[model samples]
Target: METPVRSARRESAPLRSTLVAIGLTIFGLLGAAIATLPAVLVDPMLAKGVAAASIEGQTLYMILNFVGMALAGAIYLAATGRGWSYVDFRLPSTTGWIYVLVGMGASIAFLFVVNIVVQLLSLPAAESEVVAIVGQDQTMILIMIGIVVFFNAPAEEFLFRNVVQKRLYEAFTRMQSVLLASTIFALVHFPMYVALADSIAATLTSLAIMFGGAIIFGTLYVKTRNLVVPIAAHAALNAFQFGVLYLAIEYNVEGVGTSPSAIVGILPSLPP
Candidate 1:
């Protein structure tokens, strides 16, 4: 009788977890869509009168999106009676810092190597595009960097790595959670302007690279159960990318640019 009862409870656990995950996913998506509604509706209307309206609109959209996600997370956690202490913000441990540094170094090295290969291959250069985007207003670029590195990175990590990843991990295995969360992260970036014929294909490729990166970050978070490690790592990575762009412009460096696909070339071949 005891053994049968325990088996029944164990079998039902996964089903309950899956239901929770599905609910969270739906809430998150809905919240995100609602958050962007102002930008979708109001930004264009005020575009002509206010030169800075576009930037303001983008900022508002980001703020709302983060707030919405946070609210949704709060609701889910409250409903489940999961302890609120799950939002661990402790700084990464010494070993975590080591991982962060190593990860950052590897990412920068990959970018450099890929740029060289891309130049040699004569692929399209991103320098011109970068310049066109950032050259017009130096102040705007600085502000944008501040927003992205400081505000955006932390918010994104909180949403994807902290909240979504944790919830997904509870429902699925480590590998499944990592892949799914990374895929969602990459999918969110697909609307950005790009020349790729199939945005979905490009997104999947980006997600794969991001998935690898996310795994490293995810592992650090799981080991320490701290948000700080992933947050620092996330911010550092964003800063590095910004630094690369700033240097590329400042030094007038030009080369055929590497897309995320170049990660394949940059990473060392694994043993068969």
Candidate 2:
């Protein structure tokens, strides 16, 4: 015997959860954009003289991006009367650690397969703008490796997995939540490739690859119910890719074109 008021509330719950998820997704992107403003504006005026594209400049940008996302996440939690307690912050169990390793292996294997498919089809996969600056500079690549490990991976996992995906769980099935969150993750990253992707095909290919990476990340988060798993997998995959980049640059390996950016753009590397 459901009362009318109770029925209305039940009907609205999913809608409310949906709207909240959308809002948080937008905020995740907006936070990164807004948080990096200091790098875009004030940092240039300071005595540091860090060019926005230099390794130091990019590192600063990433750090500020994380700060912005953290602020945005905090604001959301506060508005909802939720807090850090709302997220599953527990350490991974031994089983969770196994999932983490599996996630990394799966993601790497996915990227390798994607490269082969793209080449077979002759589709151009766009690289991140950062690729140009960090291309062959072992020093810069090393710095970026550190940035991805510490700042980039955690910030993205915090926003997409801990925040966005978690919110959607209230309204959707767990797999649906993972899927929707992965889509949002890909969409948020779509703009970074538009100007540089060369064509719609290339841009879409890049987005699809990133979408797959997010799926891997989201699936693992749902599977383990722990943020640390996805964060570790994401950070490890990026670190490995960058490490490879370092070796390629150091050894002058051929055929290592800008594609590595596409492979690791799951970091969804921020725009320049």
Best by lDDT: 2
lDDT of 1 at 99: 72
lDDT of 1: 0.55
Each model's backbone clash number = 0, 1
For model 1, residues 1-272, the per-residue Cα lDDT tens digits are: 57988899877866675555556655765765565567656687333322234666645555565556656766666777875777877667688788767766765565566456545864442122222333444454555466555655566666666777787776577767766666555444433323322455444444445556666667656766777777676667656665555555567665312244322211010000
Each model's lDDT: 0.55, 0.77
**How many times do residue backbones clash in model 1?**
0
Cα lDDT of model 2 by residue, 60-101, tens digit: 777787767767877898888888898777889999999999
Inter-residue clash pairs, candidate 1: none
lDDT of 2 at 257: 44
